[model samples]
Each structure stands twice: as C-alpha cells, then as structure tokens.
Target: MARNRFDIDENLESPFDIKHFRRAMIYIRRQKKPMIVAFLLSALSAAIALSAPLILQHVVDVTIPEKAVGPLFGWSALMLATIVVSVVLATIRSRIMTRVGQDIIFEIRSDLFKHLQQLPFKYYDDRPQGKILIRVVNYVNSVSDVLSNGIINFILEMLNLIFIAAFMFAVDVRLSLITLAGLPVFLGIMLMIKTRQRRAWQAVSNKSSNLNAYLQESISGIGVTQIFSREKRNEGIFTRLAANFRKEWMRALRFNALIPFSVDNLATIVSALIFLVGLLALGPGEATFGVILAMSSYAARFWQPILNLSNLYNSFINAVAYLERIFETLDEPVTVSDVPNAKELPPVKGHVRFDDVTFAYDPGHNILEHLSFDVKAGESIALVGPTGAGKTTVVNLISRFYNLTGGQILVDGHDISQMTLKSLRSQMGIMLQDSFIFSGTIMDNIRYGRLDATEEEVIAAAKTVCADEFIREFEQGYQTEVNERGSKLSQGQRQLISFARTLLADPRILILDEATSSIDAKTERLLQQGLNELLKGRTSFIIAHRLSTVKNCDRIMYVSDKGIAESGSHDELIARRGLYYRLYTAQKMEA
Candidate 1:
C-alpha cells in the first residue's frame, strides 16, 4: 500500500447507516440516567409550551368578550407561571445535557487514545500522524453533542410534533388536516435530499481531514521546509487543501440550506391554505375566529419541530462522518497485543534464539526467510549490513514490536510470543536511531525509563552515559527544561539523554541501533568506557554502520540476503576474509 501522506485522502470505508447512529448510542447509553432526567424535563417543557395556544384561544374566544378582569388576571398569572416553569426546566435540561456531552467526549477520547496506544507500528505507518490525531482530538470532540443532546433532541422533537398535531386536531380537525398535508411534501423533499446531503457532508469531512493532516505535517516539519527553501511550495499546497475544504464546506452548506428552505416554504404555504380553506369552505360555526387563531399557532408550532428535527438530522449526518472515523480508530485491531491468558515472562538471562524465523513487512516478499541465529547470556552481538538487510527488523522482532510471519523467537528458552508484551519489553532495553525526548526537566526525562527511580538513581544513569557533564553545564543542571521532541537540545544531547533513559531500565538484554552515532568522537570514547561496565552481564545486540564501534564485540554478523552471511569475532572474521572482511576493509580504506 502507498504510504498515506499528509496530502493523501484515505478512502473512507464506512457507509452511511442507521447502525452508525446506533453506534453513537453506545456512548449515550452509558449516561442513560442523566439523559432520562433531561429528556423528562424537555418533555415537560414542551407540554407547558403546548398550553400557550390554548390560553390564547380562551382569551380571544371567551375572556375578551366577557371583559372578566379577575379571570383575565388569573389566566395571565397562570400563563406567566407556566413560562417560568418551562424556562427553569429547560435550563436544568441544558445543564444536564452539557455535562453528559462532556462525559461522552472524555470517554470516547480516552478509549480512542487507549486503543491507539495498543495499535502496532504498521497502523501508524499506513496513516498520517495528523489524521490519527484529528480522530482522537477533533473528531471525538465534534461528535460529543450529537451523541448526547442530538439523540435527546431527536426524540424530543418527535414528541413535540405528536403533541402539537394532537392539539391542532382537537382545536379543529379541518385546519389540522390542512396543516398535516404539508408534512408528506416535506417528507418527500427530505427523502429526495437525504442521500445527496449525507454524501456532500462526508466529502466535507474528508477534505477537512486532509487539510488537518497536511497542516500538522507542515507545522512539524517547518524547520526542514525552511532549510530546503520550500516555503512557497508548502504554502501553495496548503492553499489548495484549504480551498478544497472550503469548496466542499460550501457545497454541503447548500444542501443543508435546502432543509430549512423546504420546511419554511411548506409551512407558509400550508398556513395560508389553512386560513383560506377554513374561511371559504367551513361554515360560521365550524370555523370560529378563536379556532382559526389556535390552528394558526399550532401550524407554526408543528413546523417548528419539523425544522428542528431537520437541523438535528443535519447534525447527525455531519456527526456520523466524524464518529465513523472515531470508532474506526477504536476498532483498529491490535496486531501486536498479548494473546489471551498470556503469561508474564520471568526475568530472563537473555539467552536469545531465533528458530527458523521467517518474517515479512509486506506479503509475498520475505525480508528474513527461514533464518536462524542464537546468542547466549552476557554475549555482545554486532550486526553489520547493507541498507535493507533487516538489521533494524531483527531488533524490532526481538522486542516483539511486530508478530513474526512464521517461526518463533525464544528468550531464555521461553517462546516470546507466549509472554505478555509489557513484561517482556520492560526487561529489555531497545534504543532506536531517533531519540524522542518528552517535554520536561532533564531529571524527569532520564527518570522516564524507570518512573519509580530515585533522584540519585537517575543521576547515576546520566553519569553512566556521560550525559552528566553537559547536563550540569545547564543553568539548572538536572532540572534544566526541554521542549517537545527535545527541540531545545542538539541531536547529540537528545541521544545522550536517551542513553541515560535506556541505562536506567537496567535491562538484562540491550539492543542499540546506532545508539552512539550522534555523539562527538570524544564524548563517544568516554561513553564507551562507561558502556563497557554497563554491558558486563547484559546480552547486547548492536547495529551500527560505524565499523569501528563494533570492532570489540564478541561476535560480528554480516546480515544480508535474508540471513547472516558471516559470523565471528573481529579478528576471526578478518582471517576468514569473507563478507565481513570486505566490509571492514572498505570502511578502513575510507577512514
């Protein structure tokens, strides 16, 4: 599969469905108690609102003609009290729904984040970081209201329609039927526009996601863009993405506009028809002035609910686009998770073995095919190889970052696959080429590897990696603050801190993939002096292009063509004058 870059829009696999709305109902169902209370309050509020037209009819038909001052005051007071009660109930309902909305957002975000943490590297490799980030943050946020109040409002609006229609029929059947006549027309219009509107909104969501992905990528790589003098090119790309988002947004808005337009016009035409037909067709007794007044009020009230329902339907459509993406993240299979009833691997002595191991990142193209190797406890193994010879893949497999396509890896004679990932990985130290440093003080960064490590232990780890001298030079020593990804520090400084973190773990097995490449020659020489003591009883796997760095290892393996091509001590391999010998001679000539 092509890498999903910032500019690329991933194909949306989820179709529009009632099931998607039901899926959001899962989050809503969790807050059922508050939702029930809020919904009851809304129902009561609507009931109170429905009484207003009746009060108006009574005043116009009886109270005004009688000129009854005391009854008018009483009725007026009752109406005012109902209004106050409705407002209070509405306010309470709003507060409850607001809290419920926030809770749903928190829960969905937490679940998405937790699932993302368990997702394998390939999941990340196949998508833009920005796309993933948007789902967890922005998309989850967008669906919160729809999952909460949207569900409530949808049900409430239906109830309101029922209540309003019943009252209209009670006031006068003839006018009520006239008002009801517009509904089928309104329903037909909605049916005509529904699929097109949903598709348009989905397009808007896609464009928005693409824009967000590119924006995040550009921000993260701003330094590179400036260095390469590609600012204009990036800006041009951003402009196009932004324009596409706006274009899709406007197109969707046009569809959204149709909902209200259809409802409003239908309501107006129906209301006019109600008055004309009632006056012309109905006799004096049937079409009372008070009945016309009440029917007109009911006519407006009825369409209002339909209009609100249409708006809620719009919210649901837009929200499904985001919820689909959110749930998709939550549903992403954890390819590298521990098996059911997986046991914790006991503390290992690092007797590592690869038994007929076959692996492939992509199908039908094995990087390692039926390959095998072994390293006993306290051994230091160095892997030297060409660019794509699976040196990094070997270390990643040892950490169980990816499941093997076939065969098994054993640690201390126990199959690693049977072990819990946390237990296995916690006891092994794997440092990669890019050293990621979190935003925190120097001491906090070093202590991250072993969070329970004491201040003294953290300081010792830093000193062991020769990171102490430069850390002390800072104004606050170990307290010195760093920014995200350690942008405040040099690449070498970040690597040094990373080294300290790895050492603090005090693992039985250590895998360093070009760990010391960033450090200056002088600092590297000093670090090696400390690493010698650190490596005393640990089984180490080192991958470095710098041939000099691996010269002292107990064994050197030239990895290529799916397995080890050469294996021996430095001097022994030199004597053989094979693949390792040629590689060493070539580097020596360059030096």
Candidate 2:
C-alpha cells in the first residue's frame, strides 16, 4: 500500500454536503434542553429590549409635547428597568451556552478518540500521525461553538429579525417595506460569494491539516534531522508549508470579510432611504416625529440581525470544513473486529497452528501463501529468515493484527477468527523489533504488562529479564522517569525493560521478534539463562538473526519463499547441509 507523507494533503473525496450540518444535529440534540432554555432566555431578552424603542417613541411623541413630566420620568425608569432585565437574561443565556459548547466538544473528542482506538493498524499506517492528532484535538475544538452556540444563535437571530419586522410594520407599512427592500440585493451578493467562501475555507482546512502533519513529523524526527545535518532543508520545507497555510487562511478571511462589508454598506444605504421615503414620499401626516424615530430604531435593529446572520453564515462555512474532516475520521471502518457471534477464548495449553494461511498487506501481493505450521503445547520454535522474508508477518498473524486473506489459524483447537480479540491476545505476550517505551517511570512501564501485579512481582520480572542491574544504578531506581520512546535508556536497556514487561504478563505463548538484537553478547547470554524457567511449559516463538541464539531450540524453521523451506532441530539442519546449514555456516565463518 502507498503511504501518505506529512507534506501530502489528504484527499477529501466527497464535496461539502448539507448532510454534514444534518449530522451535527445529532450532537446538537444531545444538549437540546440547555439550548432550549438558552433560546427562551434569549427570546425573552430580545422581546424586552425591543420595548426600549417604543418607550422612547412614547416619551418623545406623547410625554414631552404634552408637558407630562411625571409620565416622562416614569417611562424613563421603565426603559432603564427593561435594559437591566435584558442584560441579565442575556448573561444567563451566554453562561448556559458556554457550558453546552464545552460539553459538545468533550463528547465529540471522546467519540473520535474511542473510534481511533478501535481502528486497525492499517488505518494508522496509511496516514501521518499529525493528521490524526489534529482531528482529535484541533478540528473537534473548532466546531464546538458551531455545534452548540452557533445553532442557538442562528435561531435567535431569525426570531429577532421577525420581531423587529413586526414592530416596523406596526409603526408604518410604507417605511417597513422600504427598510426591507435592500435584503434581496444583499442576499444576491451573498449567493455569489457563498461557493467561493466555502471553497476557500475548505482549502484553508486542508492546508492547516498538512502543516500540522509536517510540523509533528519534524518534531518527532528532529534528532534524525540534526544527525544528517539537514536543519536548513527542513526549515525551508516548514517555511513553505506555513506559507501555504497562511495564504489559504488569508484568502478565506477575505471572503468572510466581504459578508459584513456588504451588510454594512447596504444597511447604511437603506437607513438613509427609509428617512427620505418616509418624510418625502409618505409626507408629514403619515410619518409623525415619534413614528419616524421608532422606524429609524426599527431599521437599525433590523439590519443588526442580518449582519449577525451573515457572521453566523461565515462561521457555518468555516465549521463545515472542520466537520467534514471530523466526521470522516468517525466513519472509518474497523476492518478487524470480533464477529457478532464471537466468544471469549478459553484458557489454553499453548497449542498454535497455522492451517494453509494466505495473507497480504495489499491485494494480489501475498507475503505468506498456503503456509502451514504447528507447535505443540510446550515446544520452543525459532524462526530464522532473511529480512523481508515474512518473519514479523508470521508473528503478527498469530496476534490477529490483520485479517487473513485466506485460510485460518487455530489455538487449542478453536479458530482464532471466532474469538474475542482481547481474550485471544491477553494470553499471548509479544515483543516486536521496536521496543516502544511510553513516558513514565520504570516501575510504571513494567507494571503496564500486568496491571494488578504487586511491587515484588514487578521486581522479580525485571530480575528475571536481567533489567534489574541497570535500573538500580539510577538515583530513582524503579521511580526513574523516562521520556517517550525511552530516549534516556540505551537500546539494549529498552529491550531489557520490554522483555521484563512481557515476562510480567506470564503469557501462555511468548513471541520475541529480534528480542535481543541490541543487547551485548554477554547480556544476551545472561538473558538466555534467565529465560530457561520462563520458557518452561510455555509455547515460545523466537526470531533472531544470530544462529547461535537458536542453536538450542527444540526446532528451527528456515522461513523463505512464502513458507517454511526447512524445519528440524539445530543439529539435524546442520547435518543435512541444506538452506539452514549453508546460512548457519556462513554466519559461523563471519564470526
């Protein structure tokens, strides 16, 4: 399979669909109760606030002209009271929506992370790690406000527009029509900009994702960069990616900027037209001073919501880009999962069989074809092979990391495909070529193998794998903090700790692929001595390039050409002078 590099922008196969918004309704519905409360409070606040203009109209046209001082003061106090009440309600609504926004973010991120964990290794292998991290962390965060407050604000603005229009119509029909005459023109301009704006923002999202992917990859491989003395080259690459992101972001902002500019320009024109038409066209009799004042307030109020709607529309376009990426991750299929009728694997005596197994990472490119092998309950099998000869693939198959293209694998007379993954893998201990160490203390990392293991058991496992000697040299000993990938520990030390971790699991079947490749010969010898008891009654598969390492195994299989070419005890293979004998002799001469 072709793998994607950090610099490559991930292809978005589908165009922006209304379904993205519709799909968001699922997360929005989860917080409907809070949203409903917020909406009601917002509506109430808007309703109370609209009365301020009418009160001003009443004071200007009714009270002052008639010299009604008491009425003027009373209305003034009432207007002030309305302003306070509206502000309080709005504050309450803002608080509720903030909480709802955070909750929506949490749920989205949680779901995205959960789905990511269930995805097969192939899913991760195809994309850059940075791309996955950005979706779970950044993209999810970007859409929280859109999914929560954006939805409620959209509704509130629409309601506000309706209320303002109703008040204007009540004041004067002629002026109301004139005030609204600019809407069609504004909407036409928006329709023209709509596709351009969405496309630009989508570009922005893609550029940002690409930048993040490269940034993360560079950070993780910074040591490699310095070792190769390629800092300037990497810097140039980063500068190029950063420039692309900024360029796309600015382009999207330019389109977004036009929405408000169009709204404001049209609004000022309509406000001027409202006055001219009301005074000149309708005459003084139809347009009273109080009526004119109230209509002016209504016109301003009217355009305010329209401007808000334009901003919200901008937010939607931006958010849809993020939502597309987020939902895409959520929709990734779990290629390897338990069947509907799968059952938990029972405890076994460690009999494993590969029955004519055919497997491939990609279609028509079989790595292992029609291969059959069996190991008895307590036998030690060493797989010896050249690189790229299906050594690691064989071990990965036993763990069921990838689904088989053809054939079946059985453990203790039960098909592994019919077993739950957790139950199946829990009994097997696997140590791969890369001994990954997480960020934590030595004890904590070892305890990860058996969560319930006691401190004494952990120490014993470390001792059994010969890791205790080096661990004790640290000032913190078992408490020594290690960085991720165990950068502070030697390659051999990382392998020893990894070996200790595997032993702590006390697995029925243990697989070590290049388990001691980095360790010095003396340490490897000591480790071999320590493994004697651990291998007793436990089925083990050891893959090593060193012929001497496997000289004592019960059987050695020379794996090549998509199957085992030779299988026998070390002495028998040497006597036969076949592929295994030739390879063993070549290594012995090299030594």
Candidate 3:
C-alpha cells in the first residue's frame, strides 16, 4: 500500500476554494478587535483620500474664480490637514494588521506542533521530517502577508473603487461610463493570469518540499557519504533538486511580472479615453475647468484600485498554495488515541502474558503468529534469534509500542489495551542498540528518565551503571555537554550513559535489546555486575547476540519461524544439542 502523505491534490477544479479561504480567515477572526479597528481606520483613510479631488475642484471652479483670499486659504489648509490625517491613519492600520498577522502565524505554528505530538508513530513513519518542518516554518510564513495585508487591502480598495465610481457618476454620467470602458478588459486579463499562476505557484511549493526533504536526508547521513566516498554523487542529486525548485520559481515570477505591465497599459488607455470624451462631447461652460479636472482625478482613482486588486490577486494565489499544504496536514486524523473510557493501570507487579498474539507492521505479512508467552514476577527471560526472527518484536509488543493484530497482551492480569498508554509504558523501561542521546549536559540527559530526579539521585544512577568513573574523567564531569546525537562520545560511552538514564527510571519491567552490543568486553564485564543488581526484582527480557549474556538468564528462548522453537537453560540447551547448542558452538569456533 502507498504511504499517506496528506498532500494537497493538484487537480482540484479551482485554484482555490472559497471554503479553504474561509478556513484561513478563521485565524484572522480570532483577533476581532484589532481587525475592526483596522477596518474603521481603512475606511477613514479612503474617505480622506477621496475628499482631495473634490477640494481641488472647488478651488478651481469657485474659490479661485471668486478670488476671495480668505476662502482660498481655508480650502488649502483643509486639503493639507486631510493629507496628514490619511498618512497617520494608513500608518496606524499597517501597525495593527502587522500585529494581527504575526499573532496568527504564532497560533498556527503552535497548534501544528501540538497536533504532531498527538499523532501516532505511524503518521511520522509515512511522512518525511523535512516536509513536516516546511509546514511549520516556511508554509506558515508564506501566508503571513495574506492575513496582514492582503485581506485588509482587498477590502479597502474595493470600497475606494465603489465610492470613486459613485462620485464620478454623480458629477457626470456620460464621462463616468467612458472612464470605466476599459474595466472589462482588465478583468479578463486578471482571470486568465490567475488560472496559470495558481498552477505555477503550486509547482513551486511541491519543489520546495522536495528540496528540503533531500537536503535533510543528505545532511543526516553525511557520515555514510564520507565513509563510502559518495560525496560527488550526492552533490549531483542535490544540484538536480535545487534546479527543479528554481525552474518552478521562475514560472511563477513570469506571471507576476505580466500582471503589473498589463494593468499599467490598461490604466493609460482608460485615462486617454476619458480625456477625449470630456473634450469632444462637452461645449463651453457646460464642462467647466474644475469639473473636467475633477473627472480626470476620478478616472485615475478608479484604475488605481484595479491595479491594487491585480497585485493582490498575485499574492493571494501564492499564499493559497502554501495554505492548502498546511491545512492538509492539520486535517489528518489521529489514528492511535486512547479510548474514551480507558483507565490507568494499578501498580504493576511485573507479570506479563502474551496470549496467542499475532502481529505485523503491515497487513498480510505476519511477524509473530499465535505467539503465547508468560513471565512470572521477577523472572529474567532472554530471547535469541536470527536477524528476522522477531526477537525485538516481542519486546515491543510487551511495551504496547504497536498494537497486536490478534489475541491479547496482559500486564499484571489486566488487558494492556484497556489501560492508558502512559500508565502502561511509565512502569516499563527500554534500552535499544543505538541509544539516542539528546544534546544537553550529561546530567540533563540522565534526568530525562525521571524529570524530578534530584542531583544526588542522578549521580547515584550513574554510579549504579559504572558510568560515573568515566564521566568524572572529563573536564566538566557530569556537567559535560553531549553534542547532537552524542557524536563527541564513543559508542561504548553513549551506551553507558543510556544505561544510567534507564536505571534512574527504576521501571518494574526492563527490556535490553542488544544493549551491550557496542560495549567493549572489559566495560561489558563491569556493566554486567551493575546489571545483576538492577535486574534482581524486575521482570526483564534481554535480546542479545552474545551467548554469554544469556547464559545467566533463568531461561533462554530460541525464536525461529515466527514462534519459539526451544526453551531451556544454557546447560540443558547444550546437553539437548539443539539450535541453541549449534549457535553457541559456531560462535565459540569463530572466536
């Protein structure tokens, strides 16, 4: 089956749906007070701008002709005040909208991060981390302008257009018609541009996601590239991905460039038509100099909004493409969640039972079939198997990492599925082969096992795992910072730190999946002494390739062909001369 990425469908009938646009507006709606203030300020600014032409007309037709100095002075001062008010209002509106836009971006990013935390492991397994990062960082930023400037400006320009047209028609109906004759042509051009630009911007978004994914993968595996001498080959792959991104970016830029050029030419044509009609159609005194000047101003104002809308349309298309990608991720259903009536498990006694359990990571391919096993309280069981024999799968099932497809797993006589995952996993500790060490001071990484652990307790846990001796050798001792993935530390040292962390948790049940594989023989012997004390009263399952590790367990199960083929202690298994005996002999011969 194909993995679900929750990607947007590029074949949607429209470039953008009203429903998606409305959903984006919900973030804007949250800042209702600031939005209201912005709207009012925008209206006031438009009104002030519209009054300029009327004042000019009055000065030319009445005030200047009358030659009354006092009245002329009053009108000039009034026009200057209007200009000052318009500038102030525009500045205030911009500030308010900018704040609102940032707030929306913050909320969306926070919510997306929180949602990702709630999603099941399967969700992340199917999607790339870089793609998820793009949604949180890049895509959210792309829509910032739409919320900050696009919506408000679109509304303001439409209102300006309506008011200007009303004033123009009220002054002279014939001239107003002549001024607007080019509007249909402008609309047709914008419609054509919108369709083509939407697809181009969508391509740009896809290419960006691809480039980010490839870059993240390459950087994370840089060690592999250097070890295998693949630097030149990997560079070729990165170059191709980057080239694809640039190609789509240029396609979108072409449409953006054409929009302004078309609007500018159309504006010029409309102005010329309005001038000719006013001159030829009107006789002397019928069209006064003041009236003609006012009409000319109205004609210019009319096309200005058209130009603004066309530019806004370009931005809207780009923003919507990113918005769709973000929303698609947000809308994915969380598949693994606690049932409504789930209850916390009581204090665990470390007794586990897997009754006829069958499991698979994907459908139709079973890893464990009818697997029944039981471990009494405080028992130590070791699982030994070949590479695909499902030894780790059994440990994962015990911790409920993945739900079983058939039968039941029980912890202390209670069905694990009926218990809250937190309650079940908190009492269990797992230490895997490649133990991940987060970047922080050694003390902090150990404290992650138990957040509220005291400094004294942390030191004691390190000593229990024989890690304190080596830890204190460093200049900073326990205060030493581990670089990303603990790269500064050796593999053996990393395992010792992880051992200290798990020991601090003090779980009732423990799982060690090849936990000692990286440790040198001398350190492994030291670690074994500490392990003996830690495992005394806990139910533990150890999966190890080293036959020596399993020799001391109460019982060893050799897993094969999707089930346990034999179970016995080391001496008994050796006497029986079964699979375990052959494996031990082969290992001894190799050594």
Q: Which candidate achieves the best lDDT against the true structure?
A: 2
What is the overall TM-score of model 2 with all chains considered together? 0.97
Q: Candidate 3's residue-wise lDDT over 256-351, tens digit each? A: 988788878877777777677667667675677788889989988998898888889888989988988878878777755567899999989999
lDDT on C-alpha atoms for all candidate structures: 0.90, 0.92, 0.87
Error of 2 at 491 (Å): 1.9
Off by over 4 Å in 2: 1-3
lDDT of 1: 0.90
What residue pairs clash in candidate 2, if any at all? none
- Report the C-alpha lDDT of model 2 over 143-204, residue by residue, as the tens digit: 99988988888889999999999999998898899899999999898999898898898888
All models, RMSD in angstroms: 1.4, 1.6, 2.8
Model 1 per-residue lDDT at 88: 98
lDDT of 3 at 42: 89
Cand. 3 TM to true fold: 0.92
Which digits, one per residue and each the tens of the lDDT, describe model 1 over residues 286-361?
A: 7878889889999999999999999988887888788777767776789999999999999899899999999999
Clashes of 2: 0
Question: Candidate 1: which stretches are off by over 4 Å?
Answer: 14-16
- Native-referenced Cα lDDT, model 2: 0.92
